[model samples]
Target: MARGHWLDPLARKVLQAMGELPPEPSARPTPAAPPEPPSWVVDVNRASASQWRQLPGCSEAMVDLLLRLQRGGVQFSQAEDLIQLLDLPPELAERWRPHLVIHWYGDAPPQPPAPPLDLNAAAPERLTAALLWPADRLQRLIQERRRRPFDNLADLQERLCLPPEVVEQLIGRVRFGERRPGPSLPPGC
Candidate 1:
């Protein structure tokens, strides 16, 4: 056997007694297994822009887009849904997988369509046809509007001395708008 392969007499005796020899030590230490990522799970469905910004690779534009979509009643039910919504790269999505959590709170109720007629801006003839008001009442309404447009049903009712039943009926049929600017029409015009 070569001198390098030969073990010391005492060491060989110990190895023989132990039944095996330990492996030779290397010059460099063996590397340990990679550490797991820290848990920073965030519920994307309800996370604020700042929270979204806290993620490793999230961008300001992505946060803004998320907020806009949220405001428009969009809900993301999964990380994949968000990835698709923002068109995120697979690598970025994978990077975000451990930190992102999705929670779904059922879809928001639909909003009712706006009333077609604006009480503050409608013509007297239109008001007469829609509201079926007497000519005198319609004239009074126009005069009141000319002074200052009705802000809402309460304001309209108060200014015109309309009954509760009239205001109630106007609820879904009428809407008020900001007062129009410029010269007011002359009385009885």
Candidate 2:
């Protein structure tokens, strides 16, 4: 018998061994639906570790650090408060900022906005505000600058006293008021 002719009987025997075969055609192996994404809930003052972990793009380490900060009597008054904590990355802090809630303490007066620094004329406050460094770190940077002004962009990179990535970020955001005739001025000049 022809090879093609043998296929029909083989198919029949296989189907018969498996009990009654279907007369009509049927689709096989339906596709499964995609899983739903994790839901996010912003619980301002009382968010748990599990809740923090649910945030999109948050890592296990990041969530643990956030919970630790929360448990250490640190109340997040503003989204930017995360920057004050040393463990959290600036990028992750900024990303999760919108999800945080501010709980008003009793009789706390509305705080005024910090004055903007003149990157060209003013001190490290300009850089600190722009780069999100703590006060002590900012002071150290300012002290370093008082010794000598930065001669060029490379000098700024060398003496900025921040994480290299943060220095890069500051470099991007810094708006030089006017190009000094020669090179970039160092901090605190």
Q: Indicate which candidate wins on lDDT.
A: 1
- Name the weakest run of 10 consecutive residues (lDDT summed) in model 2: 167-176
Residues 57-148, candidate 2, lDDT per residue (tens digit)? 76776666555434433344455433433235767666666666667443442332444233455655557656577778666656644555
Q: Which stretches of candidate 1 lie above 4 Å from their native place? A: 1-37, 107-189
- Model 1 poorest ten-residue lDDT run: 107-116
> Tens digit of lDDT per residue, candidate 1, span 1-189?
464438786786587567586544442358998988756777876789888988877888788767654544445545655665455788888888888877767653223234448888888888998888878889889988878776545456656767544553554456676665655433332
True lDDT of residue 159, candidate 2: 58
TM-score of each: 0.39, 0.31
Residue 20, candidate 1: alpha-carbon lDDT:
88
CA-lDDT, candidates in order: 0.66, 0.50
